[model samples]
Target: MDTKRIFRDFNHCKFLVFTCLLPAELFVSLYLDSVINWSLWLVLLPIWTLKVLVIAGALVGTIVWCHKPFRRNEADGFTDFKAMLITVGIQVLLLLFELLLCNKIESNSPISWILVFTPMYLVSTLSIGACIWGYKNARSTELESLISLNTLLFVFVSLKLHNVIHWNWSVIFIPLWIIMCLPTIVVLHHLWTLAFLRSNFHGVDKQSLVLDTIMWIAIDVPLLTFEILLASRLDQQNDISWVNIFIPLHISLLGLIWSTFGRKGGNTWWFGLREDFCTIFLRICPFMRLYGNVECKEREGGDGSEIMMMPVVTQVVCKSPSKCEPVVAVTHIATPD
Candidate 1:
């Protein structure tokens, strides 16, 4: 798993933090704030912890790099350092936004919604610039789409909150609805394939297909349900409790947490970072080995030393003494020396 490089790589550490802490934080904060009436600061401690750690690390890295730049890889080091500063800047902006939001929610602060959302507006503006630059450089445009939609959603929400627009909560959430339907469409396609095209697959392939389809449903269904419930509650369309509306969100967060630990801890399409914390964690707590068999198989395949310890036996067919019957006998056994 290259445990040595896991912590050294910035992206790996970022992935590890998000995968382990983010979902759990969401669930905990939502539950505590909605049910227990906890202070926003206490409920958001996890986020604060993560932000502090990230900012501290970035500061330390920047200082170290400035003091003694990498002689052999100076260009890469400078580039990474620049990226780290940019990332920390973004985090600081987000923290500011959160502070404004918390103040508004808790103390009934008189900050205008537009003023509170200034950080986001800046981010979106930068994102638009990034999208343009990326397009010119033949890079991905996915971020542009997300930023655009989120900007629209934010504007709609701000208007709704300020009574500037007399739009229903459901109408204000059209961007989210659009986003959710994209994945729902994907899941529906998988279901259709599973129902009608099942004959074309077999064995492990079929099992994998089914598992993937199930995972998609497990994540998407809860998210869709939660969004619908939240909108309904906001619009006073239903008397469902806040806790009830968040139950589906809790489920989805749990699924995300499970997926983080279940899958091989490495770079992926969704999370392009690698860390061995999950592997180490599973080993330390033996009773929590939900995917033990898979881990064992991965370990066996990943290293040749483990495979060399097994004994090899060869079977030979020999004729029996009295009857014209063939008997099987072990001819040789090869063991590790």
Candidate 2:
């Protein structure tokens, strides 16, 4: 067999299979331990250790595969290593936290903070890092699309975990997470769109934006519905009432509306629509008065730009024409002009 063919086979067979199976296995172990009340270390530890070993083996395999005397420049040493390390590190951290710590605690342990918090932190960090690198290095629409989807998954997963562990049940956080997701999501959308648009113009035969739009709506609508349903079901334990349903309902409706109308022409309708509605609703909805004036702005430079630009201020009032309240801003300066 040829060396290149051998490398390709190893990547497909060993690395890919290990990467996919490790997560599935870990999640299965977690479900058994948490929801099913199975033994933790006895059933999961060996598998978890194997996952680590497989990942290590994959990393080593990838290195070996890249090593060729004649194909020195073919290897992206630091970049490939960094990417693999970050990804593997996050998976390992998640396994340790969800499998080891989450199971061990009869009650939430403050000292076990490392296991609880580290996964979210590391996953978020790696995701943001990968997104930044992908934005810079990813040369194809398919790769960029995959990265974008992964980034959204990361955000959703991280936020979901945070809410499950730390956040209280409130409609407030639903909008808050959506707000948090806006900028990164927008950037991802823009990249995916631009890549395809450019490909189309260049006659590279990319996927259709219309089809992409439809596919996005199709996937998002069902997923959002499921999320709302899950949220509603979870909320039943706490506040099983119409008011409790409002959050998830609003979330689902807004998501559908946004996907249909807001995301029309591949531009976000959230900020503008929110502003218009808030402007109108503020007159009728007395609670809207509590929100004060929110001004979204974007910052230049740093990894902060990669995830979403940080909200400079949360709550403040607009005193005058020159004065504006601080809000979460999605700046697209880093995006190609």
Model 1 agreement with the true structure over 1-337: per-residue lDDT tens digits: 2222222222444345556455545656466446566787777777788778777777666566555544315433443444455456666777888888889888988888878888878766666765675566544445345665588788788777777899899999998998888879988988887787656455535655776687778879998999898889888898887666777777776665544433432221112111134444434554433222211112232545443222222221122234332223233333444
lDDT of 1 at 15: 47
What's the CA error at residue 153 for candidate 2, in Å? 12
Worst 10 residues of 1 by lDDT: 266-275
Superposed model 2: Cα runs more than 4 Å off: 1-57, 62-71, 75-78, 105-115, 139-167, 171-211, 237-337
lDDT of 1: 0.59
**What's the lDDT for residue 74 in model 2?**
38
Instruction: Kindly list the per-residue Cα lDDT of model 2 for residues 122-170, writing each as its tens digit.
Output: 5665655666775686522222234334544445444565554554434
- What is the lDDT for 168 in model 1? 90
lDDT for 313 (candidate 2): 37
The estimated TM-scores of all candidates read 0.65, 0.41
Q: Which candidate should be chosen as best, given lDDT against the real structure? A: 1
